[model samples]
Target: MRRVERALLSVSDKTGLIDFARGLSELGVELISTGGTAKALADAGLPVKNVSDVTGFPEMLEGRVKTLHPMIHGGLLADRSKPEHMSKIAEHGILPIDIVVVNLYPFAATVAKPGVTWEEAIENIDIGGPSMVRSAAKNHAAVAVVVSPSSYDGVLNELLRNDGKLEAETLKRLAGEAFAHTAAYDATIAAYFAKKLGEETESILPAKLTLSFEKAQDLRYGENPHQKAAFYREAQGGQGVASARKLHGKELSFNNIYDLNAAYNLVQEFAGEKDPTAAIIKHTNPCGIAVSTTLADAFTKARAGDPISAFGGILATSRPIDAATAELITGKNTFFEAIIAPGYDEDAFKILTEKKQWGANLILLEAEFGAEAAGENIDIKRVSGGILVQTEDKHAVGRADLTTVTRRGPSDAEIADLLFAWKVVKHVKSNAIVIAKDRQIVGVGAGQMNRVQSVRLAVEQAGDKAKGAALASDAFFPFADGPEAAGIAGVTSIIQPGGSKKDGETTEMADNYNIAMVFTGHRHFRH
Candidate 1:
């Protein structure tokens, strides 16, 4: 292989460039660098030739026109092996630049800064850097291009492999990656311009997006063994559980991600409230949820919903994890998979982490601002092929949203419980049935194909506990049979979206059972 005769080094991020350049210089490869890079290399007590010396053009327009000269382009773009191309280059006395190292200005970083001006941001865009990189990459068969600081080690190793020469295969790969890097940089610039210009219409051509995410960890398997899976950490400034900083713990699992997302999103619903709250999540549905004056009482009430199901499940709390509530939770012998809380008391941490199982899954996070900030609407799933998206169940129905369709109005206590059940029902799967007494869930039937079947499942789950309870459905009852089934299970009040054509029949059925019914004029069908 022919040795690299000359290299152009100009970079914004000089991570491993100093060492890589030193090795190159030691191998007798001549270096042609711009102002800052030349100074850096000269500062290291190495002989350096500045681009101005080679191009013979004084740096003009504040160094913007340094490397845009014909001499520089002629050397990098020339096909040395071709007689015609070589004749032109030889006539001009332009030296062949066998390698180019350049990284563009940090435009994205500058724009992301707070209170940045358009003029200031526009000024940070680099011109000569991208041009030089593309020129070198376009002639990869004769020259090597390096655009990323992370690839410095690879480039140095490749140069060392063939005694200071880069192989053709390595050159081709580096060129491809160089183009990818430039494309991503350009896309970010375009997106910023589009947003600032307030362009509402998407361009006819698809905007190619490249998201660089580092692998967080490997799971035991994907959704299925046949399917592949890997957890990736999104870039900083992104939101939700993926971005959550795990203060302490082992690696998170596939189930942990899903449950944490559900828990975090549901807790966002209670944001800005003074009351303490706790929610238990299973299979992406809240089995039990409660709010109280104290975090301890909230967990107690929430755990009462279905203590069996709460065992080895995910727990999410809105308030800081106080010692008392942590102690109460630790006292239970059940093995919970994960617990997500805003903050943890030192004592609580010591107590919780003592258990081996809890040590692997305890996640402590700072409480994010207001639950309402989670999102306006939550997306739900029916199957792999279809989805259902609607505004999240953040609705706290006022008297205006509710209209009594039955002869008797629900008692004040029943109304409160009806609203409680309504909130729980919204988080459950479609055709969901929730039974609540006082302010706690007694039973939850979810993901059934039929309303009556859902009612029966919830009633069976509650067993004798279904008596004197209010029932909430995710959607309107298609017929009166669901209400009749609830009445047989001793339900006393019903709250539904109330848009079914059989509304009269359902209301009459409620009246016959002495059960009060109210319509909220909205449905939360979480398929």
Candidate 2:
């Protein structure tokens, strides 16, 4: 290949730009730029050539038509290895561009603004920049394409080491990075357009789907030790578990991430509530959950609901961890795989680190996520050959949304406990049952084969504590057996989504047992 001679430079992110440009200049490579980039280089006392000078055509159309001329593209796309192609470019007075350094406009950020207009979003969709990047990438056999400032140092080092020329492998790798950059850019634009169309047409979910994600970490293993796994995150991450910052402890595992996500999502239902909430999760199912006046009280009560199952489980809470809660977590043979909260006090962090045996090894994360409606939330699952996509389950019910289907109505305390149990049950697996008293989860049965079995399991777990507690089922009881089992266990108030044909039987059973039952008209199935 030919030695590196001329490199085009146009980037929105100027990070490491001047140093890279100076390195290229020291290697005797010419620098070509457009618009503000050229002005910046000249202001910095670096030699640079304007695209207008190279193309003999000034930039027009509000600076949108800068480098779309044949002079620029021909330099990037000409086949340097072919004598005929080289001759044709030379005949057209177009010098070959050995390197391309570009980064597109910030389309994603523009659309993410609170009150951005369509004209502003459209204006940020770069045209000439992508065209030049594609041209350089398509001719990677003879040209080097770079679309990120992160790649600048490596490119300059290689050029300095190889006497101003890039290796073929380096060229190929840069080509891949270039294409990925443009692809991610286009995907963001596509998403913005999809949002605009939905706003205009009163519809959501686009005809085509485009997504971009970056690897967060490589896990030791997946659900099992034999399987491999890696965690990926969105390019422009919103607040959640994946975007949470690890404040302390060991690396998270595959199962830890799943359980953390489950626990975090469950606690989000209580966001902005006056009382703090806590949920202890194992295998993506909550063993216990509770809301209380203080964060420490909530944690103690949630763990007390099922202390046996809480061993080595993941805990998620809505409020910051205080010193009192840290004391309870590290007291008396207590162990947890991870704990996530919005923040941690200095004393709490110190206490947990010094008191717990596995404190240094515990995964602690801080994330800020709250409940909001009408978000573009999507849930995806992978199958054998494809993926299943649907809207995330954000359905919520209130007291006014419920109908008392039994002869008796629930008391104020029972109503509060029932609502709390309902929120927890919505995150549980299908055929789920949750029993709670005084806003504390006493028992939970999830992923059972039948609704009756779930009820039996939850009642058994709750034992004598099931008496006078509120029971919440994710869905309506298919038969009266579920209510009969809860009734026999002394459950006083029950809440469920009532759509079954045998709803009358369930209601009759509740009435006979003097159990007040309410129907939410909504189902939450998380299978």
Choose the strongest candidate by TM-score.
2
* Candidate 1 local lDDT, 1-527, one digit each (tens): 36887899999888887898888888888988998988998898777899999888888997778999879999899986798998888899988899899998888778767668889888877888988989999999999999888888888888888888888899999999888778767766765665455434433222332334446778866666676677875322235676666777666678777887788777766655588778889878887777888898888888888888888778888888888887778775655677777778888878777766566566555445353321132334466775443334566776567788899998988898898788778778888999988667888889999999999988887888788899999899999999999999899999999989999999999999999999998888776
- lDDT of the candidates, in the order given: 0.80, 0.89
lDDT of residue 283 for candidate 2: 90
Give per-model TM-scores: 0.78, 0.96
Distance from true location, Cα of 187 in model 2, Å: 1.2
Superposed by TM-score, candidate 2 places the C-alpha of residue 350 at a distance from the truth, in angstroms, of: 1.3
How high a TM-score does candidate 2 get?
0.96
Model 1 residue 171 distance off true place after TM-score fit, in angstroms: 3.9
Residue 18 in model 1: lDDT: 85
Q: Residue 153: error of model 2 in Å?
A: 2.3
